[model samples]
Target chain A: MYLAKIHITHKASILDPQGEAIKNALHRLDYQDVSNITAGKYFETTLTSDSKEQAEATTRSICESLLANQNMETFLFTVEKVED
Target chain B: MYLAKIHITHKASILDPQGEAIKNALHRLDYQDVSNITAGKYFETTLTSDSKEQAEATTRSICESLLANQNMETFLFTVEKVED
Candidate 1:
C-alpha cells in the first residue's frame, strides 16, 4: 500500500474568493497581519497497489481527471510506502 | 512576508462521505486502483510579518481558530519565509 499526500491550489493568476474572504475576516477581527491567501483541496489517499510507481501514477491521474481543474488549478503530491 | 501551507483532514474515526463518493466515481471510471481517500482543505496563505516566530504563531492561531474544525478535523501547516 501507498499513501499519497496531495496539495491542490488555484493558479497564481486566479482570484480566490474563499481565501480573500478569510483574509478579510481576519482583518475585521483585527488580524491585519494576514495579507494574501489561496485556498484549495488536500487529499490523503491510500492506494492498495503493487508498486510505488503505480501508486504515484494513479494519484496523478486522479488529480488531473477529477481532483483539480487543469485550467485554473494545479496539484502536487508525495507518494510514500505504507508498511503493513 | 511568510508563506504558510496548511493541510486539514478529518479524524481517522470519521467517515468522509466526499472521499467515499470520489472513490466510487473512480471505480465507475475503471480506475479501481484507488482504495481510500481522506479529503480536506489546503490553504496557501501569505502573511506580512516581521519575524519567523511571529509568522508561525499567527499561522497556528489561524489554523486553530478559523481554519480547522477542532471537533472533527486536525490541521498542520509549515511556515516559510518568502523572499521579497
Candidate 2:
C-alpha cells in the first residue's frame, strides 16, 4: 500500500482571502508577530499501487482531475510506501 | 523568521462526510484502488520569533484557540527557521 500526503493551495498570484482573514483574526487576538499566512487543503490518501512510481502517478492524476482547480490552485504530494 | 506548517484534521472517531464524498467520486472515476481518504486544513504561517520553541508555542496556541476544535479535530505542526 502507498500513502499520499497531498496539499492543494492557491497559486501565488491569486488572492487568498481566507488566509488573510485568519491572519487578521490572529492580530486581533494579540498574535501580532504572525507576519503572513496561507491556507490550503490537506489530504491523507491510501491506495493500492504496485510501486512507488505508480502511486505517484495515480496521486498526480487524482489531483489534476478532481482535487485541484488547475486555473487557480496548485497541488504537491509525496507518496510513501506503508505496511498494510 | 519561522515557518509553521500546520495540519488540522478530524478526529479518528469522527465521520468525515467530505472525505467519504471524495472517495466515492474517485471510485466513480475508476480509481478503485483508492482505499481510504481523509481531508484536512493546511496552513503555512510565517511568524517573527526569536527561537524555535517560541514559534512552536505560538503555533500551538493559534491552533488551539482558532484553527482546531478540540472536541472533534486535532492538529499537528512543525516550526522551522527560514531565510528572511
Candidate 3:
C-alpha cells in the first residue's frame, strides 16, 4: 500500500480570505510576532495498489479531476509506500 | 525564527463532506484502487520570536482563539526552528 498526501493552496497572487482571517486572529490573540498565516487544504489517501507507478498515476488523475481547482489553486503531492 | 504548522480536521465521528466528495471523485477518475480521501485544513505561520516558549504560547493562543473551531474540529501542530 501507498500513501498519497496532497496540498492545495491559492495562487500566490490571489487573495486568500481564510488565510487573512487566520492572520488577523493570530495578531488579536497576542501572537503579534507571527505573520502570514496562509491556509490551505490537505488530503491523504491510501492506495491499495501494488505498484508505485500505478499509485502515482491514480493520484494524479484524482488531483486533476476533483482534488483541486486548477484555475485558482495549485496542488502538490507526495507518494510514499506504507511500511508494515 | 520558527515555523508553526497546524492541521485541523473534522472529528472522527463527524461527517466530512469534503472528504467524501474527494473520495467519490477519486473513484470516478479511474483511481478505483484508492479509498478514503480525507481532507483537512493546513496552516503555516512564520514566527519572529526569539524564544521557543514564547512561540509555543502564542501559537496555542491563536489555535484556541480562531485557528480552529474547537467544537467540530481538532487541531494538531508542530513548531520547528528555521535554519538560517
Candidate 4:
C-alpha cells in the first residue's frame, strides 16, 4: 500500500478571498504580525498499488481529475510506501 | 520573516462526511484501488517575527483562536525562516 499526501492550492495570480478574510480576522484578534495567508486543501489517501511509480501516477490522476481545479489551482503530492 | 505551514484535520474519532463523499466519487470514476481518504485544511502563513520560536508560538495561537475547532479538529504546523 501507499499513502499519498496532497496539497491543492490556488495559483499565485489567483485572488484567494477566503484567505484574505482569515487574515483580516487574525488581525482583528490581535495577531498583527501576520502578513499574508494562503488557504488551501489537504488530503491523505491510501491506495493499493504494485509499485511506487504506479501509486504516484494514480495520485496525480486523482488530483487532476477531481481534487483540483486546473484553471485556478495546482496540486502537489508525495506518495510513500506503507505497511498495510 | 517566517513561513508557517499548517494543516487542520478531524480527530480520529470524528466522522468526516466530505471525505466519504470524495472516496465514493473516486470509486465511481474507476479508481477501485483507493481505500481510505481524509480531507483537511491547509494554510501557508507569513509572519514577521524575530525568531523561529516566536513565529511558531504565534502560529499556534492563531490556529487555536480561529483556524481550528478544538472540539473536533487537531492541527499540526511547521515554521521555517524565509527571505523577505
Candidate 5:
C-alpha cells in the first residue's frame, strides 16, 4: 500500500484569517518571535497502488476535482510506501 | 533556529465532511482501492531559540492558546533543528 500526504494552502496573495488568528495566539503564548503563521490543510490517504506514477496521477486528479478549490487554493502531495 | 511541525485533526469520532469528499474524489481519480482520508491542519514555525525545552514549551502554549481548538480538534507537533 502507498500513503499519500497532501497539503492545500490559500494563494500567497490571499489573506487568511485563521492563520492570522493563530499567529496572534502564538504571540500570546509567549512565542513572540514567530511570525506569518500560515495555516493549511493536510490529508493522508492509504492507496492500493504499486507505482509512484499511478499514485501521483490519482492524487492529482483528486486534488483537482475535490480536494482543493483550484481558483483559491493550491495543493501538493507526496507518495510513499507504507511500512509494516 | 528550530522548526516546529504541527498537525491538528478532528477527533476520530467526529464525521469529517472534507475527508469524505476527498475520499470520493480519490476514487473518481481511479484510486479505487483507497479509503479513509483524514484531513487536518499543518503549521510550521521557525523558532528563535537554541533549546529544545523552550521550543516545546512555546509550541505547546501556541497550540493550547490559538493553534488548535481543544474542544473539537487535537494536535501533535515535532521539533527539529533547521539545517542551513
Candidate 6:
C-alpha cells in the first residue's frame, strides 16, 4: 500500500478570499511585512496498490474528480510506501 | 521575509467523516488497499520579519489563535526564506 500527500492551492490568477482575510488580520496585528500568502487544502490519501505507477494513477484520478476544482485550483501529490 | 507552510490534521483520537467517505469511495472503486486516511487543511503564510525567530513566533501565534482548532486538530509549520 502507498500513502499520498496531496497539496491543493488556488491558481495564480484566481482570487483567494480566505487568504486575503488572513492577510488583513496579520496587518491588523502589526505584522506589516507579510504578503503574498495563500491558503488551501491538504489531503493524506491511502492507495491500495502494489505498483507505484498504479497508485499514482489512482491518486491522480481522485484529485481530478473529487479533490480539486481544476478550473480554480492546482494540485500536486507525492506517494510513499507505508511502513509496516 | 519568510513563507510558512502550515498543515492541520485531526488528532489520532478524532473521528474524521471526510476521510471515511473517501476511504469508502476508494473501496467502491475496487481500490481495496486503501486505509487509514485523514483529510486536513493547509496554509501558506507570508511573514514580514528580518529575523527567523520573530517570523516563527508570529506564525505560532497565528496558528494558535485563528488557524487550527486546538482541541481537535494538531498543526505543524515549516518556515522558509522567500527568494526575490
Evaluate residue B33 in candidate 2 and report its C-alpha lDDT on the 0 to 100 scale: 78
List the lowest-lDDT window of 10 residues for candidate 3 chain A.
A22-31
For candidate 6, give the lDDT of residue B14: 91
Q: Residue by residue across A26-77, what tens digits does model 4's lDDT show?
A: 9999898899999999999999988899889999999999999999999999
How much of the true A–B contact set does each candidate keep? 0.93, 0.92, 0.90, 0.93, 0.71, 0.78
User: Candidate 3: where is the Cα deviation over 4 Å?
Assistant: none
User: Which CAPRI quality tier does the interface of model 4 achieve?
Assistant: high
- Rank the models by TM-score, top first: 4, 2, 1, 6, 3, 5
Output the better candidate (3/6) by DockQ.
Answer: 3
Chain B TM-score of every predicted model: 0.95, 0.96, 0.90, 0.97, 0.86, 0.92
Q: Give the top-scoring candidate (TM-score).
A: 4
TM-score of chain A of 1: 0.95
Angstrom error of the Cα, residue B40, model 1: value is 0.7
User: What is the DockQ score, from 0 to 1, of model 1?
Assistant: 0.86
Model 5, residue B60: what's the lDDT? Answer: 84
Q: Where is model 2 more than 4 Å wrong at Cα? A: none
Q: In model 5 chain B, which range of ten residues has the least summed lDDT?
A: B26-35
Q: Model 6, residue B1: what's the lDDT?
A: 76
Interface RMSD of each: 1.0, 0.7, 1.3, 0.5, 1.9, 1.8
- Best-fitting candidate, scored by DockQ: 4
Instruction: After superposing candidate 1 on the true structure, give the runs of residues whose Cα lies further than 4 Å from its correct spot.
Output: none
Local accuracy of candidate 1 as per-residue lDDT tens digits, B15-84: 8999999889888877876888888999888888899899999999988889899999989899998886
- Give per-model TM-scores: 0.94, 0.97, 0.85, 0.99, 0.77, 0.91
Candidate 1 lDDT, A1-84, residue by residue in tens: 899999898898988899889888888877777988888999988888799999999999999999999999999999999875
**Which pairs of residues clash in candidate 5, taking residues 3 or more apart in a chain or in different chains?**
none
- The residue-by-residue lDDT of candidate 5 on A3-48, one tens digit each, is 8899898888888788788777667766775745778888888777
For candidate 3, lDDT tens digit of each residue in B15-76?
Answer: 98988887786677667788677789888888888888888877887887887788888888
* TM-score for the A chain of candidate 6: 0.93
